[model samples]
Target chain A: MGGDFHWVATEPSGAGRDILPADAVLFGNGRQALYAVLMEGRRRFGWRVCHLPAYICQSVVQAARAADMECRYYRALPAADESPDWPPFQSRHEVLLSANVLGFSGLDLVPPDWPNENRIEDHTHDPWSRAACESRAGYCLVSLRKTLPTPDGGAAWSPLGLPCPSPEALIPGHAAAGQEKLAAMLLKRHYLSGMAVEKEEFRAWQIQSEAAMSIQPTSRPLPVTASMLPHLPWRRWRVERARNAEYLTDRLLGSLTAPALEPDRREVLPPPTPRRFPEQCPFAVVLLCRNRRERDRLREALIQRRVYPPIFWPLPEEAARRHPEAADFAARMLALPCDFRYTPEDLEEAAEVIREFFQTEAG
Target chain B: MGGDFHWVATEPSGAGRDILPADAVLFGNGRQALYAVLMEGRRRFGWRVCHLPAYICQSVVQAARAADMECRYYRALPAADESPDWPPFQSRHEVLLSANVLGFSGLDLVPPDWPNENRIEDHTHDPWSRAACESRAGYCLVSLRKTLPTPDGGAAWSPLGLPCPSPEALIPGHAAAGQEKLAAMLLKRHYLSGMAVEKEEFRAWQIQSEAAMSIQPTSRPLPVTASMLPHLPWRRWRVERARNAEYLTDRLLGSLTAPALEPDRREVLPPPTPRRFPEQCPFAVVLLCRNRRERDRLREALIQRRVYPPIFWPLPEEAARRHPEAADFAARMLALPCDFRYTPEDLEEAAEVIREFFQTEAG
Candidate 1:
């Protein structure tokens, strides 16, 4: 072993020094960042209730609750076969949260005429969605921790040109979360440097850190994370993921089914939209199963080959029980790992795993 | 200065080492810790809606909201004369939150038989409350930042034997917050060592750090905070506050009103209970005003003298509009700082200031 590998900032961009407008700010998590905007709106404009898509995560719901805003859902997913409808506008309705559900999928953007001040674009799942960057709303929220190797951070900026909240300082537990991540990086480096690494201990720390993050009180990003996030080669990552997603999409074209029990396979491929954001980041290569059974079977088949997929959400029981469509959506929506971590070969291997599952199951 | 003030841990005891049971956990703030318990209850026990005291802070409401718990208020304060009534319970109701309002004064313990599993005791205002340590209910939350010099910490325990989640890792923002606090401590030490301290810059950092804390996401106590908190002379501080509360109580026994515009001053003070948990800690020396006019006048008077008091809570519009009783409660409650930082002479000065204000107003 030559020497210890340095692991401090992930992106080397020194993002903290990036000359951004007062409109941009960093928060502990995407939810906190979005919640800040909602809080600001409620505090300044007396906004009480908000409109959100029924197809959403609990974090989004909790963020609004944190801001003490009453939520009423409007259909926004492509699965809901109806013209996108906005919830009936009321004076009490202060904001409309238009979420980019999956980076490459989900409903089209809400009309520009929809109240801008009342809009907070939730770009948690898809930072590459059109509204993800140039938020036409009062706030744009992006959860980048999952996208990047950094421990905890989310960014929010006002598209309406409102000043953003100042970045908050880190408390202890938050720094520890980031520290654990840094430690993991160090361990990997030590092994690469031909030093003995306690892989099991590193894994234990990884699990512990993940558990800690789940319940840790939301706060601003670590100073290290702030600098790292911006330095990321975002354009390259976005392009790569887009290409990977496209490859997977084309392979599975005519083979995927809408989340339904009757197995209504989508035979015709939807015309691919031109990527407006040069840095089009794809969170996952999402695929729909014909039913819950098919989804489970395909998931099991993939895992056996060391192929892991992310269940975007388990669809909290409450959400499922209240909205049956959400349950159906949760049961059928499967996300393939097409993150920057994967290569073209890896994508092909993952696609082949799926093809094998469907062929065997059908036969 | 003779030497640099070695500033790191807040409590000299090296607190983080304290062995705690699985039932208890420390968090970044009391509200966040309490919120975790609420989340657990809602997730595990199907607690959808809860009844809280209308006379409460936004933090409590927000905590419950953060857990997606619908709240219904039952009169817990002294406004209604009869024994406190619990809101009508339904199967969906998972828990009822009982709060210890002011550090020194508020409601008595909820009836012992009041479904222990369904109760979460908020000991934020009074950690010395009987429920503070051996939580007889599902959860007992205490906000301790105001009690000690530690930058931030709160604790909650499940005496009902509920399993507590593992502690989380710290992110950068929290560590930064702690660092800022450590810097302030160093400055204070420098000044104490007979040095010409830059008080303005110190105040700027203080203000900046405070703002940092406000926006920082809630998480478990930083490694430093957790360690510093346990090392604190908790027992001594607790006794001092109790002594202070009694002294203030004796001086103005009949002066406090029942937090109303139309005064409901209790002519007879409740009998003081013997401190079983000898380490009795009080968040503040609370004083009720005869009316909103009187409360504001006293607050202004104290501020002019550089003696700041906490305004317990500024009732949220939603809370105030729905619960008028809470708004009235907010208008009249005033809290005087009686933490360990203040001496007996300091208490005497504060009392005199209050006495002078009322006397001058009447004159």
Candidate 2:
């Protein structure tokens, strides 16, 4: 449970600048924010087609589909040390949605010539990263719940000083769901503190919260999230996450075999360091195995050692069919827990498990 | 804040029978439960028109409207000691939805000859009453959150062992909203215990929760609510409520003016007794003012004394036009809080405030 990437209540410290932009519109969750942004584009510019990365979370894909946008898949995840191959686009009618994937790298992903008016950048993985702050996309969004201890929060902002779609008053059901998640986060803190709390207790609330969020696609952020945002220690979290991710990457560097990835798929990218990128935080320490079989074997071994890592995503069927290389990347990728939850010592223990797996168990 | 009827976390004690029937389906809130039932009726029995009480909460009206049911107004309150006059029905196609208002008296409301298949009894005001338990209606529903400290809960059951409509999994937004309410309840307990908590802190959450519940008309109850229900001391709460209500009624009996009422308009019903009706609990101590002006005056006076009793409802514009007697009753009736939150001593202080308002302040 200590190594599992579950939510826990983080104590608030000194006040900082608001995590989100002043003009950003808030929503109950990221999918709602994305859907609202897409619908706004359709309303304002008659946008119909949405170009998305095939190697992405299903939630992004679902948001586009829910907006009734025609989706076109594009390949992401370039080979080692190469830039992503940016595709040519027509006009504002065809919107592009790209994510700052894992917050590891993003500087080269944005094509300078791409129309900012037709782009939406997602920084859900790491909103504190430089990529998010410097994004030139028409719209930028972040799912704050992913990074912060808040139960529900999604913010969509216009980086180009354009108007963003504002959500109406939150529906009570959505607010209630958010509150449930908040309770879960608090319960998790108790569980983590060695209290007589069942792991399933928080997990059940979390699962229910997710189901409720999926049902209500659009709503304003809960009042608690709004009030709690400024109080969250974002800078500390950023540096801590960076240290953890970097420590894990360093520990695994020699032990992990260089994955024989396909031409379009990349080997793992080392996490950003706090020294190089003070504001940036890696979403996780990315680990890529030689194949899907090896990835699963390693994942199971890590789980046995109580170091639970998550697959970034399993590709959707259509995405898998359309972009085989992205699908291949998905099969091999495992995101180790590298957020502010653990210290370098904890990562060292995790590193020992990983070394044991690769040196003694993995083929 | 001491006299205010806000939520507080109640400590769970010994296990009792589940508050809801085993076969009953749960929902995020009362409106959702009612809406789902109406929709189910439409799907099964081709039920079109729904007859509702003229004197009712807006939530009940909205639920019917959301379900697209044709609503008909029925006279619910009768002269003192007289029964509610049941109107002629047109088979099961014209469904009747009636509430056992305040749970003070309900045995006389049901027309013995009416078809049980067409009746939907709302026991939200007091679900544990003998009237609710012994009802011959086809369906009976209660909004548990109204009585229990849980954030959100609505249960629709059948007295005749008939099948009921089942709610789908809770939407994450709604579940989150409920969780928010739950958090508010816990915070409220701290506030009540003389902690330095701002009143606005919990009120904001409660307001947000209500908004979310309104937006989502249907979903299964949050798992927290389901788990918390059995542990709640319903029997003790019921007894305490009865005691508080009875003591308040005993004190206010002579101070209250028996209004020169119309034959259609009834005098206030005294709180039910624990000795005579062990399972029954009065929703509140009902007081009928001489007029709207006097009612408003007394309400303000109580607020000055830090007692915040809510108006059961204000008549909808259309309902006011259709039922003058019910509209007048809504304007004049005040429900004094008599829940488990207050002791007899607390009620005595509230009673003193009420008596002073009538004795010296009244015109």
Candidate 3:
């Protein structure tokens, strides 16, 4: 939860969409937000949910385990050719959870007139997207921590108008140590390079928190996390992120003689029309490589330069069998970073580095 | 690890002795140096080992578990006396690791001829003692970290001339991280209230070290840590420890009408021993309270004044079935601080507190 991050806010899309009733559900930390939603379908509705995006952390799988649900990967369609071929869901599944890939392409992927028993949308990747706001789903979960510089926070809203349980029931000791951990994280960030030292301190805090959890009498209901969430530097963060991504994309297109884009088959989300502000959360420039090796090589090169971009969804094999298209996309796709941390100049340098590697390989 | 209190060192005992082969074994970080000897046992005698201790922190348990061994614990023993009856070991247990009641009484409760493939002695408490210096059927492990400011170090020696594995087999990652942790602990001691911060950092480092061990490639055999290890502030650490224990003991006896020493059960080792160091590691000054509640109340009082002491070892009923004598000792035992951190003045004040509690209770 400790990171230098930003968030973008938009006017709430009011309630009154397609609705479905839900029973008890569980929530997870930021990284597993999507998986938590997907697993909930399997848990409550006995839906053998499968075919999720491949690229994600182990925590996502763990969330499923926590809920006693099984997960399988889905294939991602290539960005250039977005002909969506999703795996068939079992008729018995009353719920489906879908994600907008990196905020770039959502509509091209989702099936029109999708069955909506307990459709849940995840807003972790693109919180400011109108897709979530306009979705005709029963519920949606948002990972506030991913977008903001807060230690931990999340929200789940139900279109069915089901009220949330009291905050005490959700996370009993949430407030007891959240503030202290936040403070410790802040202190640790001050000495970032002193990772060894910082990690030690952070771990101690974690142990204490764990101990507190163990000793807590029983699970108490929590209405919601009520502390004031930090306001994000939306405008500046968005502008810089877009500018960087665009600059890098342009340079890569000019220098690399690879399959640049298949405009006929691909559909990029139109520039976000900022609702509350002139700018919004920047979307990544996702590239679908011709093969997996090229993507891996490019990823390695970028890491060597200390520029890590989010790559392939970790679609498990079982999920891939369900969503072959998603599996294919995951194998060839790579995401380039376009965040507030980089500037135009940094993008130019990154582009040149990529160009040199590909040109040398071709020669 | 974080506490608001400080311990002061007592005057050094001028007498010198060869504190080698320790008396018993402890499992955790502050375990006596004799563990090195046991690790050698693993190498020399491919014995499938099982360590008996509380299922506590990961680092301590990991050391044994990492070796592909298992650790078992005696269930919580209720207090009936100063010590619980020693529990019967599973037939498979080759070694029994025991400790001096937090620097109070040695493992004199266990009969001299307890059945075990070997008896590993841990001498964190009074590391200078020679009573159990000879390894009856097993080696002794001694931890130097508890007594000295060393970052990481321990030794295990045997009187039976058992061959040990090379020290090279000791996982390097753990040793290195342990050194760093030791340095941090030393630095953190200078500050109050931030002990938790430092301890947390140490725990993380410990975890990383353990993880590193999991992936390390199998290598050449490690050498056995020997008894003839070079001196490292042994005289100074032991002298200060004994002086502190004696200082507090004198004050408690003078202030309280009841005798501090249980004359009927006393088993004092002769002074001026040649094999062990003249000074002892003053880990704690254990006291025999009348009952569990009294000990708990006394501990609470000490904690209120920021004078923290080691926790009392509870003797469960199962333990009583095995070593009935231990049950009696477990109930009335409390260990006071006697580490090098405590000064004469601190000891005096601590003794006064203990005396006041008992005096008021007697009235």
> Which DockQ values do the candidates obtain, in the order shown?
0.01, 0.12, 0.02
Query: Residue A126 of candidate 1: its Cα lDDT?
Result: 64
Question: In candidate 1, what are the lDDT values of residues B224-323, reduced to their tens digit?
Answer: 4554444556566667767766665555443333232223442212223454234334555556676688789888888787677777578778777876
Off by over 4 Å in 1: A1-22, A78-84, A105-107, A111-113, A184-208, A214-218, A254-263, A266-281, B1-363
Off by over 4 Å in 3: A1-98, A105-118, A127-137, A142-156, A163-285, A290-293, A300-310, A314-328, A336-352, B1-121, B125-281, B290-293, B296-329, B336-363
Model 1, residue A103: what's the lDDT? 59
Sort all candidates by DockQ, best to worst.
Answer: 2, 3, 1
Q: What value of lDDT does candidate 2 attain over all alpha carbons? A: 0.74
Return the TM-score for each candidate structure: 0.46, 0.59, 0.47
Lowest lDDT sum, 10 consecutive residues, model 1 chain A, at A1-10
Docking class of 1: incorrect
lDDT of 1: 0.61
Error of 1 at B66 (Å): 44
List the lowest-lDDT window of 10 residues for candidate 3 chain B: B219-228
Candidate 3 fnat reads 0.00
In order, candidate lDDTs are 0.61, 0.74, 0.47
Candidate 3 on B33-105: residue-level lDDT in tens?
Answer: 3334445556665545654544122333445555555555533222223343345654444455555434434
Question: What does candidate 2's lDDT look like per residue over A159-268, in tens digits?
Answer: 88867887787776786677667677655654564444566768787787777785245887766566556657878788888878777777777565434323233244
